[model samples]
Target chain A: MTKTTGVGRPRASGAAASKREARLAVLDAAGELFTGAGYAATTTRAIAERAGLRQASLYYHFPSKEDILAALLEDTVRPSLDVAGGLSAKLAPVGARLWALAYADIHLLGSARHNLGALYLLPEISSPRLARFRAERAELKRVYGSLVAAAGVPGELLGIRTDLVFGLVESIAIVRRDQPDLDVEAHAVEGADSVLRLAGLGEPDAGLRDSARALLED
Target chain B: MTKTTGVGRPRASGAAASKREARLAVLDAAGELFTGAGYAATTTRAIAERAGLRQASLYYHFPSKEDILAALLEDTVRPSLDVAGGLSAKLAPVGARLWALAYADIHLLGSARHNLGALYLLPEISSPRLARFRAERAELKRVYGSLVAAAGVPGELLGIRTDLVFGLVESIAIVRRDQPDLDVEAHAVEGADSVLRLAGLGEPDAGLRDSARALLED
Candidate 1:
């Protein structure tokens, strides 16, 4: 028996394959441009130019700049949310849920880090797009918030914990963006653990405390 | 006993009094401009024009734009630091010191609410100025960090507490800036209390929590 490659070659040989690759190339270029110069400052023509494709070809893939932005946000945010959703469903006690969420966040940050600048700053530059994005983000926050609140934490306490956890993650991202030399992964893990302990999710086990100490020392 | 009203009036009389009043007027106008348009966007000429003074005369009181910014930062940040400093010195238990810092921060936010937009946005737009400001702020954080660390808390745990306390205050300011219609003073106080509690300072009486909740419910 011969081993077969997963999702074997498409029936539409050269032209379709080239078209699909071009579309993906456009999106990758747009994501980079949007994240670097902000949405308002970037243009469809520039994205096409960066992707080494004609402007019309860029339009073939994405109808407008907002379409590209929406796609980018969907591609980045949805997977992380799905992971978080899955983890929250699987994790039993609050401690495990919190740890899982932290893990998911760290992974999300690694993948979505570049787009985060665009994710945050673009909203201010474009209101209609921002409103839609914010609505989606609020839903995600609600999911996370409920998971946290279900752990017997008070409503107000949950709000603070959510903010602390999110803010630390954001701060870590900012640090990573601004200062590439720092050990961001370690910082993110240590920061997340610190917040979990502070939120009373779990007592700081000796090993965890020692790990936290080592990270801070670094 | 005579009240000595205007006894030390300058020999230059009307011109000096008018100039003094004009300078105050310019500073006041500059503050409004800075708060509204941010530091980089608000020009000195605009501030002078708003105050009905010549741009040259604006420099008579403030040597440069930075002088005005420094004045604004000092006026806004110093009182809060002073309160925190005094409280840290006076409060006996570490937890009480932390609570007092939270209270002071909430109080500061209440009184200096209008300055927050400038405070938050300035750092991102003007790195050099922000660096100078954070140098002083780092010292303050160090003082607070030491206080938290000396409380028998692990160093890593103390770092998280320090960041959370500051993040809570900053988050409240951001929320209040975005939602001016909200009762910001109440939110600040409540946020500060929530943070204090999460830091393990909420025990026994819950006095701080009660006070904060009372303000919010009002």
Candidate 2:
């Protein structure tokens, strides 16, 4: 699955849909290059070349390389951000809510459409340019921390467990690099289950899992 | 723990003992710059400068940047490799033995020394230049996979659990990035416990932990 958002459709250069298609094309190429090479080493020319466009044309869509990255982060990270609204995770049973959040996060990250997960691996993520993206991601970690705590992880152990659980979810991105054929939905369930276990919750009961599924789907 | 090997030591460029000191100094500098700027963007000149050596003198310690990275991996990752010699982990209870390996691994990785764990974060690790190092790391992963299997993770879920457990352990690397005041020994204990829980082994019995402690001490 190589960025199915607009990988094969045909489009004209002078219309509204053309701008949309070209933007997707550029994103597709940039994700590939950024994950292959470090963000700094990847050049606009290479991105344009891979997208089948001229170097000069790239600026017509993106103000700079940073903007292109901003768009990628916005596209991929927003799904994880949207799953739990305004820190509402504390309202439900901790394991069930965590399952919902983890499920939603893994599904979006594990999507066959694109390997946007690799964007998290870029060292350039520390750059001032990606500050907002990092902040949003920090909020997401806080959510995980809260849920892990509510599930009974001690205050002292909260940070380590949160890092471990998040690592379990995010490792899917690294796993995708080697095994592109990964089953996204299956891994999501596994990830959610493993996270619950780490929170000392073991497997979620059928009822809790059902509630989490209903909540996330709604 | 900024690389306990020699953070406070002094060195000159001439004697055999001094040559060993210079080599460690180069690794220390490379670890800092490589994790800071990334391996591709970090130059031999910058590394030489940081290590307080002339460009010409760097070759006396390492022939190339890749060799410098190889040395870092050898210095940091070898503790993990040395823990389980030729599948000797089967000699003990799978979970307990894994606890020992994970403890040793996390101890080395979580050391207050230079963040050599970030060396795992380098995107250039895939280059042919680091093949042996990668193979050694893979063998360590295989040990983890076997331990996870022996601890009752289903075969279908084996790879995912193995990956998750490895991510949990390796995550101490990334976790060190934000929290520099990390307590290495404490995290090693916490990391080992989290890994067991991922394998469905919550906290080990006191005697089990103590016995594994004795085994690892050997």
Candidate 3:
């Protein structure tokens, strides 16, 4: 946006940058409207208007309202999936790996950057629009289950413990939303530790948590 | 139903029984549809059809689809509120009382009688119709927070810990819906124990659990 010239490569790059910015703008606006208004009640025009774009322009980037929703959900879970996929590479113990994942997930969901996690709570969850997100969540759970099993949680407790990890992380969003003055890092640390304890691991060691936080920073 | 005589008292009692049966039938059918198909997608005709009644007959029992949903939510949480009200009189230790309350709540939420608790996940939770249920749920949280404080959960953890209690109990409905062949009582016990552990309370004692159960039974 600074001192742009009509040079061939520069104009193309500038246009591409603006295009990306518009796409992200639409996504952010849609996320807010979708989470604030029920998806059923949110319309393409509303999303477009909220994004300060024409409906046609919105459609040019995202084909449909459902597509927008799918994008929002994908954005929410993509980071968790990435973390889950790479957890083993960190070479830390199962508890640390889990703490890393839960910490990142809690921070994302609890942050004001667009509460895509709230979409998961929608009663219309039965709607097929969420099938892709559901599959992703199942994969996320599988990762948690593996980490939980490695942490010495009994076989029988796997399902409940997995549920507990999910509950602890997701509850951060709800808690932060209600108590907006919450300390995010403290809450995230507590959530990650609760997940560790839920898996039958002892309360996470502060040193281990520090290392886990460093890994997430990476 | 077994060809009762049309005498005065017999006819009156039989009519009352039949009417009550019809009401329950509608509620069960509506619950299945509302939780399975979702409230917005479900229609009165469908509920009536599922209940094996004429649409008019269904209307006679419940005035609207929203009314039916309200009934389901009220039916699910009313029992918990009632038990929570009486918990103080049970005279159990803090841990035992907490365990008993959580056990009963999990059982209710997990029961196949109606996973209407799932309905609370609906995107339409903000609908004016759910205001009454929301108020009731807030009261339930108040009761839970009081018990949680008494159970020795530190003041600092109360907000997140209370949220954890709710998430653990409510997750049962989600877990049961996913793992349909789940052992209900076993799952409930584990959920209750997990809640106590989340609060830093140790595993509840078997004798204490029994005494608390007896109190609930009373």
DockQ metric for all predictions: 0.14, 0.51, 0.33
Worst 10 residues of 1 chain B by lDDT: B117-126
When only the first chain is scored, the TM-scores of the models are 0.75, 0.84, 0.88
How large is the interface RMSD of candidate 3? Answer: 2.7
lDDT of each: 0.58, 0.78, 0.75
Model 3: DockQ vs. true structure: 0.33
Error in Å for residue B102 of model 3: 1.3
lDDT score for residue B41 of model 2 = 83
lDDT of residue B208 for candidate 3: 69
Name the runs in model 2 displaced over 4 angstroms: A1-14, A86-92, A112-116, A119-121, A205-211, B1-14, B86-92
TM-score of each: 0.67, 0.87, 0.84
lDDT of 1: 0.58
- On DockQ, the leading prediction is 2
Per residue, candidate 3 scores C-alpha lDDT tens digits across B1-218 of: 12223455545477677777678888888888776666666889998888887988888888888778887787777889999989877667777777888899888887656566656655566678868887898888888888888878789888777876776677676666566677778877887887777777766678867887887888
Residue pairs whose backbone atoms clash in candidate 2: B1-B112, B1-B113, B2-B112, B2-B113, B3-B113, B3-B114
Write candidate 2's Cα lDDT for A89-155 as tens digits. 4467778889998988888878836666665645566778888887887888888998899999999
Residue B128 in candidate 3, Cα distance off native in Å: 4.1
Using DockQ as the yardstick, the better of models 1 and 3 is 3
Tens-place lDDT per residue, model 1, B1-218, is 11123456665787777776776677677766765655556789998998888989899988888777766565555666776666644525665566556666655654563544224433332346455555665566666667557656676556655654565555444444434465544555455545555465544246645543343232
